[model samples]
Target: MIRVAIDAMGGDLGPRIAFQATQKILAAFADVEVRFYFDPQHFTVPEGASSNRFTSVSCSEHVASTESVDRALFKRCDATIFRALTDLAGEQVDVVVTFGNTAAMVALTRYIVGLLRPKLYPALIREMRPAPLKCLVDLGANVHCPADMLTGFALLGSAYLEARSDDAANVALLNVGVETSKGSSVIKDCYQMLSARSWPAFSGFAEGFELFDGGKNVIVCDGMVGNAVLKASEGLFAFLLSQLSQHSMDTTAVEKLVRAENRHGACLVGVKGNLVKGHGRSDEKAMVGAIEYGIDIARTNLSKKIEQKLIQQGVL
Candidate 1:
Protein backbone atom coordinates (compact mmCIF):
# COMPACT_ATOMS: atom_id res chain seq x y z
CA MET A 1 0.00 0.00 0.00
CA ILE A 2 1.12 3.56 -0.72
CA ARG A 3 0.88 5.96 2.22
CA VAL A 4 0.50 9.72 1.53
CA ALA A 5 0.90 12.39 4.20
CA ILE A 6 -0.87 15.71 3.57
CA ASP A 7 -0.52 19.12 5.24
CA ALA A 8 -4.19 19.84 5.81
CA MET A 9 -3.64 23.16 7.51
CA GLY A 10 -1.86 24.73 4.53
CA GLY A 11 -3.18 26.53 1.37
CA ASP A 12 -5.50 29.51 0.93
CA LEU A 13 -8.74 27.52 1.24
CA GLY A 14 -7.65 26.12 4.61
CA PRO A 15 -8.47 22.57 5.67
CA ARG A 16 -11.76 22.32 3.85
CA ILE A 17 -10.19 21.55 0.47
CA ALA A 18 -7.86 19.07 2.09
CA PHE A 19 -10.72 17.23 3.75
CA GLN A 20 -12.76 17.21 0.57
CA ALA A 21 -9.82 15.99 -1.50
CA THR A 22 -9.08 13.26 1.04
CA GLN A 23 -12.60 11.92 0.74
CA LYS A 24 -12.34 11.87 -3.04
CA ILE A 25 -8.95 10.12 -3.00
CA LEU A 26 -10.13 7.54 -0.51
CA ALA A 27 -13.08 6.64 -2.71
CA ALA A 28 -10.96 6.57 -5.85
CA PHE A 29 -7.89 4.52 -4.91
CA ALA A 30 -8.14 1.47 -2.66
CA ASP A 31 -4.38 0.85 -2.75
CA VAL A 32 -3.69 4.33 -1.39
CA GLU A 33 -4.09 5.49 2.22
CA VAL A 34 -4.09 9.09 3.44
CA ARG A 35 -2.81 10.70 6.63
CA PHE A 36 -3.61 14.34 7.34
CA TYR A 37 -1.69 16.65 9.69
CA PHE A 38 -3.81 19.51 10.96
CA ASP A 39 -4.29 21.72 14.00
CA PRO A 40 -7.08 20.30 16.14
CA GLN A 41 -8.16 23.80 17.19
CA HIS A 42 -8.70 24.77 13.56
CA PHE A 43 -10.14 21.69 11.86
CA THR A 44 -12.35 18.66 12.49
CA VAL A 45 -13.24 15.73 10.28
CA PRO A 46 -16.72 15.61 8.95
CA GLU A 47 -19.15 13.12 10.54
CA GLY A 48 -18.88 9.45 9.50
CA ALA A 49 -15.83 9.94 7.27
CA SER A 50 -13.40 7.88 9.30
CA SER A 51 -11.91 4.71 7.91
CA ASN A 52 -8.96 2.41 8.41
CA ARG A 53 -7.41 3.85 5.26
CA PHE A 54 -7.83 7.46 6.39
CA THR A 55 -6.21 8.87 9.52
CA SER A 56 -5.59 12.33 11.02
CA VAL A 57 -2.80 13.62 13.24
CA SER A 58 -3.05 16.70 15.43
CA CYS A 59 -0.58 19.53 14.76
CA SER A 60 -0.41 22.72 16.84
CA GLU A 61 1.00 25.07 14.25
CA HIS A 62 0.37 26.23 10.65
CA VAL A 63 2.57 27.90 8.04
CA ALA A 64 1.16 30.84 6.16
CA SER A 65 1.86 31.38 2.46
CA THR A 66 3.58 34.68 3.28
CA GLU A 67 5.85 33.11 5.91
CA SER A 68 9.53 33.56 5.19
CA VAL A 69 11.61 30.44 4.68
CA ASP A 70 13.91 31.29 7.57
CA ARG A 71 10.99 31.96 9.91
CA ALA A 72 9.31 28.73 8.89
CA LEU A 73 12.44 26.67 9.40
CA PHE A 74 13.39 28.24 12.79
CA LYS A 75 10.28 29.67 14.46
CA ARG A 76 7.56 27.40 13.01
CA CYS A 77 9.36 24.13 13.33
CA ASP A 78 6.13 22.49 14.46
CA ALA A 79 4.11 23.63 11.46
CA THR A 80 2.10 21.14 9.45
CA ILE A 81 4.66 21.05 6.59
CA PHE A 82 7.45 20.43 9.07
CA ARG A 83 5.57 17.58 10.77
CA ALA A 84 4.73 15.92 7.45
CA LEU A 85 8.35 16.17 6.24
CA THR A 86 9.66 14.80 9.55
CA ASP A 87 7.41 11.79 9.13
CA LEU A 88 8.71 11.44 5.59
CA ALA A 89 12.31 11.49 6.82
CA GLY A 90 11.48 8.85 9.42
CA GLU A 91 10.09 6.54 6.69
CA GLN A 92 6.61 6.61 8.19
CA VAL A 93 5.13 7.88 4.91
CA ASP A 94 5.81 6.95 1.31
CA VAL A 95 5.15 10.46 -0.06
CA VAL A 96 4.03 13.94 0.97
CA VAL A 97 1.53 16.22 -0.85
CA THR A 98 0.85 19.78 0.26
CA PHE A 99 -0.58 23.06 -1.07
CA GLY A 100 1.46 25.19 1.30
CA ASN A 101 4.08 27.93 1.17
CA THR A 102 6.27 26.89 -1.77
CA ALA A 103 9.44 28.39 -0.33
CA ALA A 104 8.82 26.93 3.11
CA MET A 105 8.04 23.49 1.72
CA VAL A 106 11.20 23.42 -0.43
CA ALA A 107 13.38 24.75 2.40
CA LEU A 108 11.94 22.35 4.98
CA THR A 109 12.23 19.40 2.61
CA ARG A 110 15.92 20.14 2.06
CA TYR A 111 16.56 20.57 5.80
CA ILE A 112 14.43 17.62 6.97
CA VAL A 113 14.33 14.91 4.30
CA GLY A 114 17.71 15.94 2.92
CA LEU A 115 18.95 16.20 -0.69
CA LEU A 116 20.59 13.51 -2.79
CA ARG A 117 23.57 15.81 -3.27
CA PRO A 118 24.48 18.56 -0.82
CA LYS A 119 25.47 21.00 -3.55
CA LEU A 120 22.37 20.32 -5.63
CA TYR A 121 19.05 21.96 -4.70
CA PRO A 122 15.50 20.73 -5.16
CA ALA A 123 13.47 21.88 -8.22
CA LEU A 124 9.79 21.76 -9.16
CA ILE A 125 9.18 19.71 -12.34
CA ARG A 126 5.82 19.41 -14.04
CA GLU A 127 4.58 17.95 -17.33
CA MET A 128 3.96 20.65 -19.90
CA ARG A 129 0.55 21.35 -21.45
CA PRO A 130 -0.81 19.87 -24.75
CA ALA A 131 2.01 17.38 -24.43
CA PRO A 132 1.94 15.47 -21.18
CA LEU A 133 5.03 13.50 -22.19
CA LYS A 134 7.15 16.66 -22.13
CA CYS A 135 8.11 18.48 -18.89
CA LEU A 136 9.51 21.79 -17.57
CA VAL A 137 11.86 22.17 -14.60
CA ASP A 138 12.23 24.73 -11.78
CA LEU A 139 8.55 25.71 -11.65
CA GLY A 140 8.98 27.94 -8.55
CA ALA A 141 11.56 26.39 -6.26
CA ASN A 142 14.60 28.70 -6.66
CA VAL A 143 13.82 32.10 -8.13
CA HIS A 144 17.42 33.11 -8.73
CA CYS A 145 19.68 30.31 -9.96
CA PRO A 146 23.23 30.36 -11.24
CA ALA A 147 24.49 28.65 -14.39
CA ASP A 148 25.51 25.50 -12.54
CA MET A 149 22.11 25.40 -10.86
CA LEU A 150 20.36 25.60 -14.22
CA THR A 151 22.50 22.75 -15.48
CA GLY A 152 21.57 20.77 -12.38
CA PHE A 153 17.90 21.45 -13.07
CA ALA A 154 18.35 20.11 -16.58
CA LEU A 155 19.79 16.89 -15.21
CA LEU A 156 16.97 16.57 -12.69
CA GLY A 157 14.33 17.20 -15.33
CA SER A 158 15.82 14.65 -17.68
CA ALA A 159 15.93 12.03 -14.97
CA TYR A 160 12.31 12.77 -14.09
CA LEU A 161 11.10 12.20 -17.64
CA GLU A 162 13.22 9.08 -17.99
CA ALA A 163 11.80 7.70 -14.73
CA ARG A 164 8.26 8.10 -16.01
CA SER A 165 8.80 6.89 -19.59
CA ASP A 166 11.79 4.53 -19.23
CA ASP A 167 13.45 6.27 -22.17
CA ALA A 168 16.26 8.78 -22.55
CA ALA A 169 14.99 12.35 -22.22
CA ASN A 170 15.63 14.95 -24.93
CA VAL A 171 16.44 18.23 -23.17
CA ALA A 172 16.37 21.87 -24.29
CA LEU A 173 17.13 25.16 -22.61
CA LEU A 174 14.28 27.69 -22.73
CA ASN A 175 15.33 31.10 -24.03
CA VAL A 176 14.01 34.16 -25.82
CA GLY A 177 15.08 32.72 -29.16
CA VAL A 178 16.34 29.40 -30.50
CA GLU A 179 19.77 30.86 -31.27
CA THR A 180 22.52 30.31 -28.69
CA SER A 181 23.41 34.02 -28.97
CA LYS A 182 19.95 35.20 -27.89
CA GLY A 183 19.98 34.61 -24.09
CA SER A 184 22.13 35.95 -21.24
CA SER A 185 25.56 34.73 -20.22
CA VAL A 186 24.04 32.28 -17.72
CA ILE A 187 22.02 30.58 -20.43
CA LYS A 188 25.06 30.35 -22.63
CA ASP A 189 27.09 28.82 -19.81
CA CYS A 190 24.37 26.24 -19.10
CA TYR A 191 24.22 25.39 -22.81
CA GLN A 192 27.96 24.76 -22.85
CA MET A 193 27.69 22.57 -19.73
CA LEU A 194 24.87 20.48 -21.17
CA SER A 195 26.64 20.20 -24.52
CA ALA A 196 29.55 18.48 -22.76
CA ARG A 197 27.24 15.62 -21.68
CA SER A 198 26.10 12.82 -24.01
CA TRP A 199 23.63 10.81 -21.90
CA PRO A 200 20.50 12.95 -21.99
CA ALA A 201 20.02 14.16 -25.54
CA PHE A 202 20.51 17.95 -25.59
CA SER A 203 18.54 19.67 -28.40
CA GLY A 204 20.03 23.16 -28.21
CA PHE A 205 17.82 26.09 -27.08
CA ALA A 206 14.04 26.38 -27.41
CA GLU A 207 11.63 29.33 -27.59
CA GLY A 208 8.43 29.62 -25.54
CA PHE A 209 6.17 28.55 -28.40
CA GLU A 210 8.05 25.26 -28.63
CA LEU A 211 6.61 24.08 -25.30
CA PHE A 212 3.44 22.71 -26.92
CA ASP A 213 4.94 21.85 -30.30
CA GLY A 214 6.37 18.51 -29.10
CA GLY A 215 9.87 19.52 -30.20
CA LYS A 216 11.54 18.48 -26.94
CA ASN A 217 10.82 16.13 -24.08
CA VAL A 218 12.27 18.34 -21.33
CA ILE A 219 12.70 22.14 -21.14
CA VAL A 220 15.01 23.69 -18.53
CA CYS A 221 14.87 27.21 -17.03
CA ASP A 222 15.27 29.09 -13.78
CA GLY A 223 12.40 29.35 -11.30
CA MET A 224 11.56 32.98 -12.10
CA VAL A 225 11.02 32.44 -15.82
CA GLY A 226 9.30 29.11 -15.31
CA ASN A 227 6.85 30.53 -12.75
CA ALA A 228 6.09 33.47 -15.04
CA VAL A 229 5.38 31.16 -17.99
CA LEU A 230 3.22 28.90 -15.82
CA LYS A 231 1.07 31.77 -14.55
CA ALA A 232 0.77 33.21 -18.05
CA SER A 233 -0.40 29.90 -19.48
CA GLU A 234 -3.01 29.58 -16.75
CA GLY A 235 -4.30 33.08 -17.46
CA LEU A 236 -4.45 32.34 -21.17
CA PHE A 237 -6.38 29.15 -20.55
CA ALA A 238 -8.94 31.05 -18.49
CA PHE A 239 -9.28 33.72 -21.16
CA LEU A 240 -9.82 31.11 -23.85
CA LEU A 241 -12.55 29.44 -21.82
CA SER A 242 -14.33 32.73 -21.25
CA GLN A 243 -14.19 33.65 -24.92
CA LEU A 244 -15.49 30.25 -25.97
CA SER A 245 -18.36 30.55 -23.51
CA GLN A 246 -19.34 33.96 -24.90
CA HIS A 247 -19.40 32.52 -28.40
CA SER A 248 -21.76 29.72 -27.27
CA MET A 249 -19.14 27.16 -28.32
CA ASP A 250 -18.77 23.73 -26.72
CA THR A 251 -16.16 24.22 -23.97
CA THR A 252 -16.11 20.65 -22.67
CA ALA A 253 -13.31 19.51 -25.00
CA VAL A 254 -11.22 22.58 -24.28
CA GLU A 255 -11.59 22.18 -20.52
CA LYS A 256 -10.75 18.50 -20.69
CA LEU A 257 -7.61 19.15 -22.69
CA VAL A 258 -6.24 22.04 -20.58
CA ARG A 259 -7.35 21.20 -17.04
CA ALA A 260 -4.91 18.31 -16.60
CA GLU A 261 -2.03 20.43 -17.86
CA ASN A 262 -2.70 23.53 -15.75
CA ARG A 263 -3.95 22.01 -12.48
CA HIS A 264 -1.69 19.01 -11.79
CA GLY A 265 0.88 19.55 -9.03
CA ALA A 266 4.67 19.71 -9.50
CA CYS A 267 7.14 17.14 -8.18
CA LEU A 268 10.00 18.47 -6.01
CA VAL A 269 12.98 16.63 -7.50
CA GLY A 270 16.54 16.19 -6.08
CA VAL A 271 15.13 15.47 -2.62
CA LYS A 272 15.49 12.17 -0.78
CA GLY A 273 11.83 11.18 -1.11
CA ASN A 274 8.71 11.90 -3.12
CA LEU A 275 7.21 15.35 -2.49
CA VAL A 276 4.50 17.03 -4.58
CA LYS A 277 3.58 20.72 -4.16
CA GLY A 278 0.16 22.01 -5.12
CA HIS A 279 -0.59 25.66 -5.75
CA GLY A 280 -1.30 27.80 -2.67
CA ARG A 281 -4.76 28.71 -3.96
CA SER A 282 -5.64 25.18 -5.05
CA ASP A 283 -9.26 24.11 -4.94
CA GLU A 284 -10.59 20.65 -4.02
CA LYS A 285 -10.09 19.30 -7.54
CA ALA A 286 -6.53 20.53 -7.73
CA MET A 287 -5.74 19.14 -4.28
CA VAL A 288 -7.09 15.73 -5.29
CA GLY A 289 -4.98 15.87 -8.43
CA ALA A 290 -1.87 16.60 -6.38
CA ILE A 291 -2.49 13.65 -4.05
CA GLU A 292 -2.98 11.34 -7.01
CA TYR A 293 0.22 12.67 -8.57
CA GLY A 294 2.07 11.84 -5.33
CA ILE A 295 0.68 8.32 -5.41
CA ASP A 296 2.04 7.87 -8.95
CA ILE A 297 5.49 9.04 -7.88
CA ALA A 298 5.59 6.68 -4.88
CA ARG A 299 4.43 3.68 -6.88
CA THR A 300 7.13 4.27 -9.49
CA ASN A 301 9.98 4.75 -6.98
CA LEU A 302 10.91 7.94 -8.82
CA SER A 303 13.30 9.40 -6.22
CA LYS A 304 15.55 6.33 -6.20
CA LYS A 305 15.58 6.23 -9.97
CA ILE A 306 16.59 9.89 -10.11
CA GLU A 307 19.44 9.36 -7.62
CA GLN A 308 20.71 6.41 -9.61
CA LYS A 309 20.53 8.42 -12.81
CA LEU A 310 22.51 11.27 -11.24
CA ILE A 311 25.17 8.85 -10.02
CA GLN A 312 25.43 7.20 -13.44
CA GLN A 313 25.92 10.62 -15.05
CA GLY A 314 28.74 11.45 -12.56
CA VAL A 315 26.76 14.42 -11.23
CA LEU A 316 26.86 13.09 -7.65
Candidate 2:
Protein backbone atom coordinates (compact mmCIF):
# COMPACT_ATOMS: atom_id res chain seq x y z
CA MET A 1 0.00 0.00 0.00
CA ILE A 2 1.21 3.52 -0.82
CA ARG A 3 0.85 6.18 1.89
CA VAL A 4 0.11 9.74 0.65
CA ALA A 5 0.62 12.86 2.78
CA ILE A 6 -1.73 15.72 1.90
CA ASP A 7 -1.62 19.32 3.12
CA ALA A 8 -5.21 20.11 3.98
CA MET A 9 -4.62 23.81 4.59
CA GLY A 10 -3.76 25.21 1.15
CA GLY A 11 -5.15 27.09 -1.88
CA ASP A 12 -8.16 29.42 -2.09
CA LEU A 13 -10.80 26.72 -1.71
CA GLY A 14 -9.09 25.03 1.17
CA PRO A 15 -10.71 22.56 3.58
CA ARG A 16 -13.56 21.83 1.22
CA ILE A 17 -11.47 21.02 -1.87
CA ALA A 18 -8.80 19.23 0.08
CA PHE A 19 -11.43 17.22 1.90
CA GLN A 20 -13.37 16.29 -1.21
CA ALA A 21 -10.23 15.31 -3.08
CA THR A 22 -9.06 13.17 -0.17
CA GLN A 23 -12.41 11.41 -0.06
CA LYS A 24 -12.37 10.79 -3.81
CA ILE A 25 -8.85 9.33 -3.76
CA LEU A 26 -9.54 7.07 -0.79
CA ALA A 27 -12.81 5.89 -2.26
CA ALA A 28 -11.38 5.27 -5.73
CA PHE A 29 -8.10 3.70 -4.65
CA ALA A 30 -8.39 1.03 -2.00
CA ASP A 31 -4.72 0.16 -1.89
CA VAL A 32 -3.63 3.75 -1.23
CA GLU A 33 -3.72 5.31 2.26
CA VAL A 34 -3.96 9.05 2.92
CA ARG A 35 -2.58 11.26 5.70
CA PHE A 36 -3.92 14.82 5.97
CA TYR A 37 -2.12 17.62 7.83
CA PHE A 38 -3.89 20.92 8.26
CA ASP A 39 -4.30 23.97 10.46
CA PRO A 40 -7.62 25.55 11.51
CA GLN A 41 -8.06 27.30 8.17
CA HIS A 42 -8.64 23.95 6.53
CA PHE A 43 -11.09 21.48 8.03
CA THR A 44 -9.75 18.57 10.01
CA VAL A 45 -10.49 15.16 8.53
CA PRO A 46 -14.10 14.15 9.16
CA GLU A 47 -14.91 12.04 12.20
CA GLY A 48 -14.67 8.85 10.13
CA ALA A 49 -11.19 9.77 8.87
CA SER A 50 -9.25 8.11 11.69
CA SER A 51 -11.07 4.78 11.79
CA ASN A 52 -11.65 4.51 8.05
CA ARG A 53 -8.50 2.43 7.79
CA PHE A 54 -6.36 5.46 6.84
CA THR A 55 -4.04 7.82 8.77
CA SER A 56 -4.74 11.53 9.32
CA VAL A 57 -2.47 14.07 11.05
CA SER A 58 -3.61 17.51 12.14
CA CYS A 59 -1.89 20.64 13.43
CA SER A 60 -4.00 23.52 14.69
CA GLU A 61 -1.07 25.85 14.11
CA HIS A 62 -1.00 27.52 10.72
CA VAL A 63 2.15 26.53 8.87
CA ALA A 64 1.52 28.55 5.69
CA SER A 65 2.25 32.26 5.51
CA THR A 66 1.87 34.31 2.29
CA GLU A 67 3.86 37.52 2.70
CA SER A 68 7.32 35.97 2.61
CA VAL A 69 6.39 32.99 0.49
CA ASP A 70 6.40 34.91 -2.82
CA ARG A 71 10.10 35.65 -2.42
CA ALA A 72 10.94 32.48 -0.53
CA LEU A 73 9.13 29.22 0.09
CA PHE A 74 7.39 28.53 3.39
CA LYS A 75 9.56 27.36 6.26
CA ARG A 76 9.64 23.59 6.45
CA CYS A 77 11.68 23.25 9.62
CA ASP A 78 8.68 21.92 11.56
CA ALA A 79 5.66 22.68 9.41
CA THR A 80 4.14 21.61 6.09
CA ILE A 81 6.70 19.49 4.18
CA PHE A 82 8.74 18.77 7.28
CA ARG A 83 5.70 17.58 9.19
CA ALA A 84 4.65 15.19 6.44
CA LEU A 85 8.20 13.96 5.91
CA THR A 86 8.62 13.35 9.64
CA ASP A 87 5.82 10.86 9.34
CA LEU A 88 7.37 9.46 6.17
CA ALA A 89 10.66 8.86 7.99
CA GLY A 90 8.79 6.83 10.58
CA GLU A 91 7.31 4.75 7.75
CA GLN A 92 3.95 6.42 8.12
CA VAL A 93 3.78 7.67 4.52
CA ASP A 94 5.20 7.22 1.04
CA VAL A 95 4.23 10.33 -1.02
CA VAL A 96 3.28 13.95 -0.22
CA VAL A 97 0.86 16.17 -2.22
CA THR A 98 0.17 19.84 -1.49
CA PHE A 99 -1.25 22.96 -3.17
CA GLY A 100 0.77 25.26 -1.03
CA ASN A 101 3.65 27.62 -1.95
CA THR A 102 6.00 26.34 -4.68
CA ALA A 103 9.16 27.84 -3.20
CA ALA A 104 8.38 26.26 0.12
CA MET A 105 7.72 22.96 -1.60
CA VAL A 106 11.04 23.12 -3.48
CA ALA A 107 12.99 24.15 -0.38
CA LEU A 108 11.45 21.49 1.84
CA THR A 109 12.02 18.73 -0.66
CA ARG A 110 15.61 19.81 -1.31
CA TYR A 111 16.47 20.26 2.34
CA ILE A 112 14.60 17.47 4.06
CA VAL A 113 14.24 14.58 1.60
CA GLY A 114 17.59 15.28 -0.05
CA LEU A 115 18.32 15.04 -3.82
CA LEU A 116 21.22 13.53 -5.76
CA ARG A 117 23.85 16.14 -6.39
CA PRO A 118 26.16 16.53 -9.47
CA LYS A 119 24.27 13.78 -11.33
CA LEU A 120 20.77 13.37 -9.99
CA TYR A 121 20.46 17.03 -9.06
CA PRO A 122 17.83 19.54 -10.28
CA ALA A 123 14.09 19.87 -9.46
CA LEU A 124 11.65 20.87 -12.20
CA ILE A 125 8.07 22.07 -12.49
CA ARG A 126 6.62 20.31 -15.53
CA GLU A 127 3.17 21.00 -17.05
CA MET A 128 1.06 20.83 -20.17
CA ARG A 129 -0.60 24.00 -21.41
CA PRO A 130 -3.25 24.47 -24.09
CA ALA A 131 -2.48 23.69 -27.76
CA PRO A 132 0.30 21.05 -28.01
CA LEU A 133 1.12 20.91 -24.26
CA LYS A 134 4.77 20.34 -23.42
CA CYS A 135 6.64 19.60 -20.19
CA LEU A 136 9.22 22.32 -19.32
CA VAL A 137 11.66 21.37 -16.61
CA ASP A 138 13.26 23.45 -13.83
CA LEU A 139 10.24 25.76 -13.90
CA GLY A 140 10.45 26.71 -10.26
CA ALA A 141 12.69 23.85 -9.28
CA ASN A 142 15.96 25.73 -9.65
CA VAL A 143 16.92 29.34 -10.35
CA HIS A 144 20.41 28.63 -11.63
CA CYS A 145 21.73 26.08 -14.14
CA PRO A 146 24.62 25.15 -16.45
CA ALA A 147 24.78 23.45 -19.87
CA ASP A 148 25.51 20.11 -18.26
CA MET A 149 22.64 20.65 -15.84
CA LEU A 150 20.29 21.62 -18.65
CA THR A 151 21.23 18.44 -20.49
CA GLY A 152 20.19 16.58 -17.40
CA PHE A 153 16.91 18.49 -17.57
CA ALA A 154 16.53 17.25 -21.13
CA LEU A 155 16.82 13.65 -20.00
CA LEU A 156 14.32 14.16 -17.19
CA GLY A 157 11.70 15.88 -19.35
CA SER A 158 12.01 13.07 -21.87
CA ALA A 159 11.49 10.30 -19.30
CA TYR A 160 8.54 12.06 -17.71
CA LEU A 161 6.51 13.32 -20.70
CA GLU A 162 7.18 10.27 -22.83
CA ALA A 163 5.07 8.22 -20.45
CA ARG A 164 2.51 10.95 -19.76
CA SER A 165 1.96 12.00 -23.37
CA ASP A 166 1.42 8.46 -24.62
CA ASP A 167 5.04 8.15 -25.72
CA ALA A 168 4.77 11.14 -28.04
CA ALA A 169 8.16 11.79 -29.63
CA ASN A 170 7.75 15.58 -29.75
CA VAL A 171 10.60 16.62 -27.50
CA ALA A 172 12.22 20.02 -28.16
CA LEU A 173 15.00 22.13 -26.75
CA LEU A 174 13.73 25.64 -25.88
CA ASN A 175 15.83 28.36 -27.42
CA VAL A 176 15.52 31.79 -29.07
CA GLY A 177 14.61 30.15 -32.35
CA VAL A 178 13.99 26.83 -34.08
CA GLU A 179 17.17 27.22 -36.11
CA THR A 180 20.23 25.14 -35.35
CA SER A 181 22.26 28.36 -35.00
CA LYS A 182 20.21 30.04 -32.26
CA GLY A 183 20.89 31.46 -28.81
CA SER A 184 24.29 31.79 -27.12
CA SER A 185 27.40 29.80 -27.82
CA VAL A 186 26.50 27.62 -24.86
CA ILE A 187 23.09 26.69 -26.23
CA LYS A 188 24.36 26.31 -29.80
CA ASP A 189 27.15 24.09 -28.61
CA CYS A 190 24.67 22.08 -26.57
CA TYR A 191 22.38 21.73 -29.57
CA GLN A 192 25.20 20.62 -31.85
CA MET A 193 26.37 18.22 -29.19
CA LEU A 194 22.84 16.91 -28.68
CA SER A 195 22.21 16.49 -32.42
CA ALA A 196 24.41 13.40 -32.36
CA ARG A 197 23.24 11.80 -29.10
CA SER A 198 21.23 8.66 -28.45
CA TRP A 199 18.26 9.18 -26.12
CA PRO A 200 14.66 10.27 -26.63
CA ALA A 201 14.74 11.26 -30.31
CA PHE A 202 15.29 15.02 -30.26
CA SER A 203 12.47 17.13 -31.73
CA GLY A 204 14.75 20.06 -32.47
CA PHE A 205 14.58 23.67 -31.17
CA ALA A 206 11.50 25.53 -29.91
CA GLU A 207 10.93 29.20 -29.25
CA GLY A 208 9.19 30.66 -26.17
CA PHE A 209 5.76 30.93 -27.81
CA GLU A 210 6.33 27.64 -29.60
CA LEU A 211 6.78 26.02 -26.23
CA PHE A 212 2.98 25.91 -25.95
CA ASP A 213 1.29 26.58 -29.30
CA GLY A 214 3.38 23.87 -30.91
CA GLY A 215 2.67 20.27 -29.94
CA LYS A 216 6.03 19.79 -28.29
CA ASN A 217 6.16 17.17 -25.59
CA VAL A 218 9.35 17.76 -23.59
CA ILE A 219 11.22 21.11 -23.45
CA VAL A 220 14.65 20.96 -21.82
CA CYS A 221 16.13 24.31 -20.79
CA ASP A 222 17.68 26.18 -17.89
CA GLY A 223 15.59 26.90 -14.83
CA MET A 224 15.72 30.64 -15.48
CA VAL A 225 14.28 30.44 -18.99
CA GLY A 226 11.96 27.64 -18.03
CA ASN A 227 10.61 29.63 -15.10
CA ALA A 228 10.11 32.73 -17.23
CA VAL A 229 8.31 30.67 -19.83
CA LEU A 230 6.19 29.11 -17.12
CA LYS A 231 5.18 32.48 -15.71
CA ALA A 232 4.46 33.74 -19.20
CA SER A 233 2.28 30.77 -19.99
CA GLU A 234 0.49 31.09 -16.67
CA GLY A 235 -0.14 34.74 -17.33
CA LEU A 236 -1.57 33.93 -20.74
CA PHE A 237 -3.78 31.19 -19.34
CA ALA A 238 -5.14 33.66 -16.80
CA PHE A 239 -5.55 36.31 -19.41
CA LEU A 240 -7.52 33.95 -21.61
CA LEU A 241 -9.75 33.07 -18.68
CA SER A 242 -10.33 36.67 -17.72
CA GLN A 243 -11.31 37.44 -21.30
CA LEU A 244 -13.66 34.50 -21.34
CA SER A 245 -16.46 36.72 -20.16
CA GLN A 246 -16.13 38.74 -23.36
CA HIS A 247 -16.81 35.75 -25.53
CA SER A 248 -20.37 34.75 -26.43
CA MET A 249 -19.51 31.18 -27.40
CA ASP A 250 -21.12 28.42 -25.37
CA THR A 251 -18.64 26.59 -23.17
CA THR A 252 -18.88 22.95 -22.21
CA ALA A 253 -18.64 21.86 -18.58
CA VAL A 254 -15.73 19.51 -19.27
CA GLU A 255 -13.78 22.27 -20.99
CA LYS A 256 -14.32 24.63 -18.08
CA LEU A 257 -13.42 21.97 -15.52
CA VAL A 258 -10.26 21.00 -17.41
CA ARG A 259 -9.08 24.61 -17.60
CA ALA A 260 -9.77 24.97 -13.91
CA GLU A 261 -7.75 21.87 -13.08
CA ASN A 262 -4.78 23.06 -15.13
CA ARG A 263 -4.27 26.12 -12.94
CA HIS A 264 -3.47 24.31 -9.75
CA GLY A 265 -0.86 21.64 -10.29
CA ALA A 266 2.80 21.13 -11.25
CA CYS A 267 4.93 18.03 -10.92
CA LEU A 268 7.84 17.88 -8.44
CA VAL A 269 10.58 16.04 -10.34
CA GLY A 270 13.85 14.60 -8.98
CA VAL A 271 13.79 13.49 -5.37
CA LYS A 272 14.28 10.41 -3.20
CA GLY A 273 10.96 11.43 -1.61
CA ASN A 274 7.52 11.78 -3.15
CA LEU A 275 6.29 15.38 -3.48
CA VAL A 276 3.86 17.31 -5.70
CA LYS A 277 3.27 21.06 -6.20
CA GLY A 278 -0.18 22.53 -6.64
CA HIS A 279 -1.48 26.04 -7.21
CA GLY A 280 -1.86 28.34 -4.25
CA ARG A 281 -5.40 28.77 -5.47
CA SER A 282 -6.01 25.06 -5.97
CA ASP A 283 -9.48 23.62 -5.51
CA GLU A 284 -10.68 20.08 -4.86
CA LYS A 285 -10.07 18.86 -8.40
CA ALA A 286 -6.50 20.17 -8.42
CA MET A 287 -5.60 18.76 -5.02
CA VAL A 288 -7.09 15.42 -5.92
CA GLY A 289 -5.09 15.25 -9.14
CA ALA A 290 -1.93 16.03 -7.19
CA ILE A 291 -2.53 13.01 -4.99
CA GLU A 292 -3.31 10.76 -7.92
CA TYR A 293 -0.32 12.07 -9.84
CA GLY A 294 1.90 11.06 -6.96
CA ILE A 295 0.36 7.63 -7.02
CA ASP A 296 1.06 7.40 -10.77
CA ILE A 297 4.67 8.41 -10.18
CA ALA A 298 5.04 5.63 -7.68
CA ARG A 299 3.10 3.03 -9.64
CA THR A 300 4.67 3.91 -13.00
CA ASN A 301 8.18 3.69 -11.56
CA LEU A 302 9.03 7.25 -12.73
CA SER A 303 12.04 7.43 -10.43
CA LYS A 304 13.56 4.35 -11.99
CA LYS A 305 13.27 5.74 -15.52
CA ILE A 306 14.81 9.00 -14.37
CA GLU A 307 17.73 7.04 -12.94
CA GLN A 308 18.35 5.22 -16.20
CA LYS A 309 18.27 8.42 -18.28
CA LEU A 310 20.38 10.30 -15.79
CA ILE A 311 23.06 7.67 -16.26
CA GLN A 312 22.66 7.98 -20.02
CA GLN A 313 23.29 11.72 -19.84
CA GLY A 314 26.32 11.06 -17.65
CA VAL A 315 24.62 12.94 -14.85
CA LEU A 316 24.62 9.86 -12.64
In candidate 2, how many Å is residue 138 off? Answer: 2.3
Q: lDDT tens string, model 2, 1-316?
A: 8778887665677666787888898899998887777765446557766745466666645446363444233343446556886665455677777776666666666666666554555566567652344677777666666666666677667766654556655667788788776687767766765666677677778877765566666787776777777767677756666577468544455357556445345666666555677766766766777787788776655655666656665656
lDDT of each: 0.87, 0.67
Question: Which runs of model 2 end up more than 4 angstroms from their true locations?
Answer: 40-43, 60-77, 89-91, 117-119, 129-133, 162-171, 192-196, 212-216, 231-247, 253-264, 309-315
Best by lDDT: 1
Clashing pairs in 1: none
Each candidate's TM vs. the true structure?
A: 0.95, 0.78
User: How does candidate 1 score on lDDT?
Assistant: 0.87
Give candidate 1 regions above 4 Å deviation. Answer: 129-132, 260-263
Q: Residue 250: error of model 1 in Å?
A: 1.4
